[model samples]
Target: IHWHMNISNQINYVAADEKRQIIPYIHVKDMQGRVTEYFAKDSPLTPDQIAKAPRHRMDCVDCHNRPTHIYVPPDLAVDQSLLARRLDATLPFLKQQAVTALTGKYETGDEAMQGIAKTISEFYESKYPEIGKTKQLEIRNAVDELQRIYRSTTFPEMKLDWKTHPNNIGHFYFNGCFRCHDGQHVSPEGKVVRKDCDICHTVLGQQEGAVSMASISGTTFQHPVDLGDLSAVNCSDCHTGGTGP
Candidate 1:
């Protein structure tokens, strides 16, 4: 980002390892307040505007989260909910096709499935007219069908040992806990590089008797125990631990 990691090009990493770059699409904000359709479609991010804050910082969690990115900022991935809604509008039968495709395969005799597939392809071509050699759009087609499965709230059995400790107890956004939290923030590179608390926060001692609305001070909520408290819960919070928070 313009703030950390790649700051002013002065901080060169001495870890002696390789690095990757974040390919960004600079989005331009239209300040002219034009209302006409012709002008709206044409406004785009100019090369200069994109170069305003040129920097590269990589967080392994961003790229590997499959289809869903947890630790990434909004600038990275496309909004799934919004895409589903848009795709739903054009093809009303998307939900049924999705259910059939996911729960079971679509019948070769089905006309609806065939029709939906053709229209959906054309729809993607219309929206992302410039989608190039990358197979991203093709993948999106598969995901759109899966999104129907998610939106329908239908999933196969997922067994959980309810007696296990709480690893993640947190609210979910676009997905049910199971859909997103199938894997913890752990990545394969995690074996080589550990994600310590310092990467994101400084979890100070708990402030005892502090008001719910009060901010955390250095000294408050002092549990009369050592650093490794018995009820450490192993993790600070969890988002998708089978049966949620």
Candidate 2:
């Protein structure tokens, strides 16, 4: 099981102040009442204050979003305790959501839940190489029910909250490539060219398993360097003070 944000476009309700305004609050507690974070909208904390905050804070789906695969870790890679609570909560919601995705309504949610249960059973049965004779009939029955549902409806549109720009706190608290080099806006206006493979280098063994990181021969670099005997036109060769012609 995994933990991800279950909300979107979050408007925090903090009526503790005089004005009844919903601040952009991130719910930092899970079902087990663990503090995953302590983010507040207007009450920005200083470095010292932030340092004093707790390490673990829990949040809903608005914070833990899935991008293709479950890329985020730490806060998202759920354990047994959290998973059980989430499963109990998610199963009912999943039924409603799946039905909505299919028929655009929740009326069929009960039936959808049954179908989901059967599908899960079938999936587990098929996961093994071979089932015992005793298990085969049960697996068959479960799978047959799931298959009926498959013909009955389609899947939902998978949505994700992704990083549109750099520097904003990540969609998740995990390692991601977009955390740094998410090329959106730049200062030097095209000077930091959006790079492609062909712009500076070429991929030789694209289909092959192993490929070289070194520059290919004959691709003369714009900034060339010369040594006594050998000549290097590629970057890093002379930049690192290597002998080149």
**lDDT, model 2, position 150:** 33
TM-score of 1: 0.21
lDDT by residue (tens digit), candidate 2, 1-245: 12333332222222222321212223334455544332332343444554554432224322333424332221121222135443222222233322222222223445545555554444444554244244555444433433344333322233222111111123122222122122321222232212222443444322223643344442322222234322211222322111111
**Lowest lDDT 10-residue stretch of candidate 2:** 159-168
lDDT on C-alpha atoms for all candidate structures: 0.31, 0.31
Off by over 4 Å in 1: 1-4, 9-239
Which lDDT tens digits does candidate 1 get at residues 78-155? 234336453333333334333333333223324334543554454446654554224455536555554443323322
Per-candidate clashes, comma-separated = 8, 21
Q: Could you estimate the TM-score for every candidate?
A: 0.21, 0.21
- Worst-scoring 10-residue span by lDDT in model 1: 34-43
State the local distance difference test value for candidate 1: 0.31
Q: List the residue pairs that clash in candidate 1.
A: 168-238, 169-238, 206-220, 206-221, 207-220, 207-221, 208-220, 208-221
